[model samples]
Target: MFVSRLLDFQKTRYARFMNHRVPSNCRYQPTEYEHAANCATHAFWILPSILGSSILYILSDDQWETISAWIYGFGLSSLFIVSTIFHTISWKKRHLRTVEHCLHMFDRMVIYFFIAASYAPWLNLRELGPWASHMRWIIWIMASVGTVYVFFFHERSFGGRDAGAGMREQGRAAMTCFFHMVAPNGKQKAPGVSPKPQTPDSELAAPRPG
Candidate 1:
């Protein structure tokens, strides 16, 4: 039957894609199926994320709100956009080591900005007491420091394996602080107003060893 022939063809293609060997210089290389899935997952969300951010920006009632909206929107869109491009390149142009390496670093860097942006609306809009008020500036400073660290010391200071664990711990600590401040009274404050933190699955996608 035609359906049987189609299934056999698919199996052949899958085997061919999966049989490719990981390059020696790369820490990890995804199978073709993984590359395609990662690219699709992030690409699919790009437009919706942008549209949602635009809606939030339009709904803002004041200057501070508008600024927060803009920050959050840019962060949200860039996260998806950069992720999609990176994965697409990874899948389609794996041979371009230099270009892939640069994008891989950039992809990692965007997560810090996204974290700060996720908290922007809440930190700017709510009153979290005098001590907590400083968190608004503190979060950004932390993000900036994180960016610099990723740029200069990511895989350089520690070997590739440990560096990832350290980055994850740092991200976890940052989120923990954000949640603690957001809910000092032990109740969710903003409900639908504040965007929930996002962890892109592509964050774990393998990068070439530099």
Candidate 2:
């Protein structure tokens, strides 16, 4: 259905023009073409993730991050494609606004999970001194809380003023900080309080006098 419309929209010049035939909730507001463009942009991530996974799989066999990297690629690819499809559908099916809005929430719910899942292997497996052990767990904890909250408040978030957009942005920011804090970029920082002294392993790896 949507796949066909996406293809047709490209072929037909008239369909590409701006219009207001979409739902009020669609991020696709102001113009129909903008909606199509957003969907297409997200859908574009699908192929690159697939190809990236295949390439990485061929390059590394036993590395845990390699395995997780594959999972990350495929998992996020699906999230992006699904988001694109339902976002399009939510716009196209103007009459089913309520149902479509719910569908959009489900789409976002997957994203909340995927963010944690995809980051687990990469962030947790790295040698981040003391932080590696629980960084992934912290992310899962946040994701778990988010999943439950999103499901329970699915309607209110969608229907209430400033509900959907506000919560999504704030939650995304807060959850992102959890993983980013543990980034192995070698930056100094704290998780719960002041940064802990580097573990013996970090001390051993420190550069010796030149």
Candidate 3:
């Protein structure tokens, strides 16, 4: 009877605590790099399509001589190259994967569509005529719609705290290994496997009075 009442009390206390409100201003915000990374990811979704359109335009219209093919090729390749750099930097420093790996995967599918749209004209080397123009228009419309949803979903799934917390936890684990003479909490390992060396500051240092 006593134990049941104690359990009920604990449950109620927890419920009350959980219901407490957090201040809006206290909410965590993304770091500038993280924000930039998010913006880049969204921008990337549209870029291939945009480049492909330009390439298609140059190829389709014989009179479209203003834009150089070499310039378009160089620019298109550079955008993808820059995106790779962003992914590499984010992975190494933050250990943060982009939020929508699946959506990004989907975006890649759209990229192929754009590439095909661009390449189809040149490949057949015949006029796209009526049918091909309609297909290209359809691809553009679908890509624009998909990009909006994917970007919105990604922003909601990932936040700055996710990146910060991941790095912080790693640092904590390393600190634990360097400090305690024994395993922090877990059972001792076998004789052959040596434990990590403990640092001096973690041992026997007299605590200063508060």
* lDDT winner: 1
Predicted candidate 3 versus true structure: per-residue lDDT over 83-139, tens digit per residue? 555444544544444543543444333443334334333323322333443443454
What value of lDDT does candidate 1 attain over all alpha carbons? 0.74
Clashing pairs in 2: none
- Total backbone clashes of model 3? 0
Q: How close is every model to the real structure, measured as TM-score?
A: 0.68, 0.58, 0.31
| Clash count, one per candidate | 0, 0, 0
Off by over 4 Å in 1: 1-26, 156-210
10 residues in a row with least lDDT, candidate 2 = 187-196
TM-score of predicted model 3? 0.31
Model 2: per-residue lDDT, tens digit, 1-210?
888778665367775475535454445443676777877888888888778777766875355656667777667777877787786786677578777777777786777667766665555344445544565566667666666666676544445543346436544644444444444676643233344576798779999999
Using TM-score as the measure, the top candidate is: 1
Which ranges in model 3 have alpha carbons more than 4 Å from their true place?
1-61, 64-75, 95-117, 120-125, 155-210
Q: Candidate 2, after superposition: displacement of residue 8 in Å?
A: 34
